[model samples]
Target: MALGSLGLVAGALLIAASSRWLPGELPSYPPAQNAAEARPAASLAIHDARPGQPARRIAEDLIAPPPLDVAGVERIEPRPPLGELGLASPPQTPMPQDWRETLLYRPVATSSAIFEAMGRRVVISGTIDVDPDRTCAFGDAVWPCGQRARAAFNAWLRGRALKCVLPPDVDRFGVAAPCMLGKQDVGAWLVGNGWAMASPSGIYGKAEAAARGAEMGIFGPPQ
Candidate 1:
């Protein structure tokens, strides 16, 4: 019994020594699978996934372009050029009423005829008709003979109903050669007939001493 007991104790020691040497049966631990690391791989597969269903179609309604409206516009008419028309006629002016009638008339009888016919037909007598030489000789000579002669001649014209147109100059004798009576050159007729002579002084200056010195017509005896 002691030997058996010794063997049993030895067997028990071997069992204890084997247990220290050998590892326990680990609770079926799956090969340390990195589940956290596998999560990224699963997420990448979902991100790269293609659309299996038909793509959603978007509805679009395009508006048509507006039509152009050009109406009711007025057009300007062109005017004809001035050169196209003929030259314009000048405007007529009215003449004066008085200018239309004649105002002058010629005489029939000359100075000689008129003088000869004095008293009967025409009479011209005044201090004016007296020669300036005869009148100047007397200091008390009244009436300016030359001036009176012109006045008498003018008066004769008035009496005859004729215009008096006296010559520019007269002889010392106070005789006008080309005296005009109503536009009639009576003096010219007298000078032409050698009855009166041309004078150097004017009709008014015929009485001057210088004019007298000329001894023109009626100043000296009939030549």
Candidate 2:
């Protein structure tokens, strides 16, 4: 009987010690009155509203827009074909290593002719110019050979166009250039005819020799 009473006392002491040391029951959270209140307003609105119309316009905006009305929209028209590409004027034939200029000549000396090119005056090339007043002697007779040579050259030109190869850079006056009249070289013709001497560095040496041998122009009896 005494041992049973001791046991009862020991159990009462354990209960008292635990109550003092352990934390009180956590404060009970108030029971949620409305389950909808616990949820977000947007979700609650969607759940509470009737199903016919959208519950929230903001939620409706998230849905992808209806497919584009391809059949109703207009399409762009294609561009017209471009006109055939062409130059304003006919293209000139290309020549290598030289500019081909067309010039009108007026004989100024036995070997030189004056012409205008790109608004500049130019003199013919490849010969030693002979003065218009120069006189030539064949045996005991003397003649105005320079004037005659000029006249002959002028007659040959007769206002025809000459295709000339002139320096890209030329002086204001006395611009010497090689020219062609049909198939003939003007300078070579002058030297070959003995009306003028070939320039020191010119290509008319053979023409000059031939003229000398034939005794043509100033080398022959005045003609």
Model 1 over residues 92-169: C-alpha lDDT tens digits? Answer: 233334322112233323332233222122211111233423222223334333333333344444445333322232
> How far out, in Å, is residue 11 in model 1?
99
Per-model TM values vs. the true structure: 0.19, 0.49
Q: What would you estimate as the lDDT of candidate 2?
A: 0.69
Model 1 ranges with Cα > 4 A deviation: 1-135, 138-143, 159-184, 188-197, 201-223
lDDT of 2 by residue, 1-223 (tens): 9999999999999998878754555454795467757877756433336589756434554467877888899888987647423314323334447555655454333333444544556566667766778899999999998888877777777767677766555546556777888888888788888878877676676777889899998788888
Q: Ten-residue segment with the worst summed lDDT in candidate 1?
A: 118-127
Top of the candidates by TM-score: 2
**Candidate 1 residue pairs that clash:** 118-122, 128-148, 128-149, 177-187, 178-187, 178-188, 179-187
lDDT of 1 at 167: 28
Off by over 4 Å in 2: 1-100, 105-120, 168-171
Model 1 residue 135 CA deviation (Å) reads 7.4
